[model samples]
Target: MPKAKLKPDVTVFEADQRQQEAIEHLHGPMLVIAGAGTGKTTVLTRRIARLISERHARPDEILALTYTENAAAEMRTRVRAELGGSETSQMRVCTFHAYCNNLLIRNGRNFGVLDDQDLWIYLRKRIRELQLNYFVRAANVGKFLFDLNDFMRRCHDELVGPEKYHAYVERLVRGELSIPRVTSSRDADSISDQEVLGRCREIDQVFQVVERMLSEENLGTFGHMISKAYELLNLTPELLSQERAATKFILVDEFQDANYAQVKILRLLAGEEKNVFAVGDPDQAIYQFRGASSAAFEIFRNQFSQSKVVALEKNRRSTTPILQCAFALIDKNPAIHATENNDAAENGGRRFQRRPLLSERDEKAGPAAIKDPVHAVSLTAKDAECSDIVHVIQQRRKQNACQWKDFAVLYRLHSHRDMVAEELAEAGIPFSIENMDISNTAEARDVFAIMGAMLAENDGASLFRVVATSD
Candidate 1:
């Protein structure tokens, strides 16, 4: 057999040495520590094209998993552009949830999965069945259900089932587990140990009921879909073997955002061949509260012991000043440095070391130099903060002769938007919120009422709503 040759049109050969190494790697596990603006997407798409062009793996056999649907779509489009639509038509590029959901759809006959809407409907109907001591009030029922759903989702992400949760609660009850004390005055409303144990018991009871209901109805939520897929792969040797054979290569983007369940699923799929390539930056990890592990690099290293690590240190998008400012801010967090050092010590002193980004942009060649890459301001009240922000934007617009489209206001929370929007509107400034929910708007409500009246025919409430909004 002759060795495979790369296609002449492939653009992966033009990448820098580190990126080229990651893209051209033929076998075994590899991790690429890609920083912001490091062309990680380029590396990923080019790697897929290279794999196909070199005849290492067919397009259909390669699986690319991303954290978001938009990222997956973008990756698919780039790969299609490289290899042509027809050649890459069968490639799998999707979110972790989407991949798991597809598997459950195809092989989860024993487990009937409930989507978000279905799960919401079922929980809304059966919520009252789970008797609770603290959160049993009628007014807080919605909050209780939401918190319960979130807790259960987190448990599922960690691969903890109802049985494990119940056992843990029992251990708490038996004094096998200790509760940490509330240290701050802000935690004055924190429950006592007895109350904490009581809540745990209630949660356990709720978990058992929900699991039983799912089992009886042969239904599972999106979280359950992931857990159930892992179960199928682990317990069924034949299915696992078939899946491993089918998926020859696995490439994960934004790997730091992957939870334990997703990581476990990938491990199972990789099997012994371990043709897994993950690219992500630990500094960009922001989903820890939602089960994304902060020590994702360490976890990946531990799992794939033979995996080679590569770093993309060039900052191709940002200026030198911006990179320097970011580095300074991040350096204040000693915990990150400590973790990196410890990981290096544990892994034969060959960690994916963090280095200052080398910006490709020629700062001196630009028309205007960046005077201040970062600015800081402190305001006491929310109103004052919003006012100052609007004032700054107005001044900047006037100075630069910029349009409204050139300005953007970002808030940490959705609650902050109302005040900022109020300030913007009062100043006669036009702005649009990115993910505003228009469903609850007056016009949307009126349209919904009209549709409801048309569908029901005899719905007096809907007709009344439509009539009330007409004038």
Candidate 2:
């Protein structure tokens, strides 16, 4: 028996050329254009570790934020692994909402906001109540209300609160301003001055309800969570100053997915020192549906003209052909391609193209190697029987000479699974459906009962549903 050799852990001094550049350059702002599997996480965690272990940065002052709790946890885990428990324990790695909640708990009262409000729990309920009240009679106002909620949230993300929103409403109601033509859910109306004014009034009504609720009841919406934090930072200058002084560096993960409000929060926290490290790929910006602005990343990068941009060109994930195909697919979009190239070039990627420079995986993981490894075969009710699909699966299993675990069947809609499942069963093939469609699940019905009870105290139906469905 032989013991495997354990290589010495790579120190900051021993970092790869590009990673070393990102980790060592800690003075001002830096943007790392790290593509998928480029070890952006490596750069981020290592940089934080470097600051704690070498630069004498107070762990408390370093704020590392991400879009999701999962990402924050991942970064925290990496930092913990990189710089022992003592150093990582003092640092704050959190999502935007959690970080804002921290500020709210500490300094929100100083700004007269989030002080007595149930911003975290009842915000959604409050918004829904307002929409039901204000737009009860409007046609298809339910859909419009959904969009209005998003529009207001975007305002919050942009650090625009009730007062600023009222100003915009005044202009719109007066026909002095025109709504920008939009292709998003936020697009309400701007057909004519009269129509625009009508829609403006509708929006204003919803906002007025929101403001009154917040001011009188001290209850706020999710929008207020972020915007109020921005407000708290602004209204309490001393607190902001103290915070800026305390925070030496801010590292933002998935910068491309950051909407306007999150980006603004980071910038304000960065303050004049501008010690922020943001790592993201513009090509990977896919949060457009929920008010994320990919342009926010580019705008921030350009704001600091002297900010060093490092491109993590080599990818450790996908094979070259797959990367090439992805590049070509995304490059077809003129806007995305242009943004990627421009940012990459500015970020010191002279040879930067719309796609990432990919390397070989341990084994081939590309289209060329796997000839239609998975394909969807459309079926009609009249198309023979389920055997068509089951037989295909069987043939593929035998041809590839793989086990049942190696094969998979996916459905776009969950209900569509039953028919294929029945076929699989009849064919004596084993299969499993991955995602849950709550409508067909007892657990979901129980949840509905609970939510229904919360929404209406006197709803006998929901109450009975809860009692009857109880395990």
Candidate 3:
């Protein structure tokens, strides 16, 4: 495969100081504070290319961490285009969960675990022991299972052990127990003891079977992979040393989105002298609900005292108006470090906009630099803000503003997606859910069946025929 040439200034749009620094550094624990649309993906791809071409790091030795399989695929595609070929395939471009799966599957029997379902069940039992709220309404076993599966994927083994999951569960139950009293003053409180009791019972039943399976059948989850990997590394430090010896660089994208288990894996892999680069935006840290901590950056900083912090704040995505609106919305959280001050006029600037020339400036000034000024607009009231946004969206629709493909509705949680999903449904608007795995589809049973048959005695054709006979 031909190598994609390095042309950071020309190839990548808005390749700013921070991004350029990240691309060229090729050393130590470095944190890239990549703001939205700041060409983070571009920098990452270039960084990977540099690692392979200049640093002489084998593609297989470098690891690129992502949040989702789709993001992983996107990263792989971009990196492949950047480096050009089966080269990027050698590099492990995967989510934290996928990395865990790789570790666990490769070394399953060492932990006395076999089969994913049994592993999931075992992990669920431990989660219950930890008293992790199987659901908002515990009686909702379906919801519990759905959430449990996801939770298991994230921290399978951490919950498997009695310590972490136990503490997590205790805290969760205590919080739930206090919810009723806390909301008693509210005239319209939603807390229900009956719901909790039912959910608790369902959890108890599910856990009982899982506990039995773990003790009797010896099963575990993906967290089991992390835990096992840690154990294996500890048990064979020389092996990990060898692995680290080969890896000249390990770049973790969206580092802030990583949980405890993942950080542990990286810490172990990075060891003492290995170079590690983590790029993410803490302001966009939305997975606190799922146990991700931005504090990993702080920890890494402290651990590697020589580390340099780089901020890729100049966004090359939204227009002045869009950036202003997005930034305003993002700043609602207290944790955000407000670099752009109260006065939006001078401080705020838009790096990029999608469209034809709107102003007289464009007509006279040929094409402005991609880093042309963008003015920030403050949103005073929720209704006014919504109205303003609706107007822009409506205008876009009328003028063929941006293609439906260009438009995206982003939120911090699945629950937040509900309103838009419902509205889209009612309006009969067709849209597909992005950044989700095919394995997460409602037809996961079919996938499981196919996988099971492929690995088992039965052929996939026979299993498909059997599964297709729904009636």
Quote each prediction's TM-score.
0.78, 0.72, 0.64
lDDT (Cα, tens digit) per residue for candidate 1, span 338-386: 1232355588555345667877554434756454567779878756999
Sorted on TM-score, best first, the list reads 1, 2, 3
* Candidate no. 1 TM-score: 0.78
lDDT of each: 0.77, 0.67, 0.59
Model 2, 1-471: lDDT tens per residue?
A: 222222234643244578788888778888787778778888888788777777448678799989777788888877877765544667889988788877887853422233111232234445466654335555665455566666766777677666777788887667687664433445445355555555566666667776776566444555677877887887888988888988999998888787777767777888888898988877777776656654765577556556776777776766666666667666764343123334556674443345546554523454444332223356675444456768877998889887888777766556667778888898888777654445647566657768977898755445555654456
The worst-scoring run of ten residues by lDDT in candidate 3 lies at 351-360
| Cα RMSD, model 3 | 9.0
- The alpha-carbon deviation from the true structure for residue 1 of candidate 2, after best TM-score superposition, in angstroms, is 40
Q: Where in model 3 is the C-alpha error above 4 Å?
A: 1-14, 84-86, 108-160, 163-212, 215-218, 336-439, 450-471
What ranking of all candidate models by lDDT puts the best one first? 1, 2, 3
Choose the strongest candidate by TM-score. 1
Output the lDDT of residue 171, model 3. 56
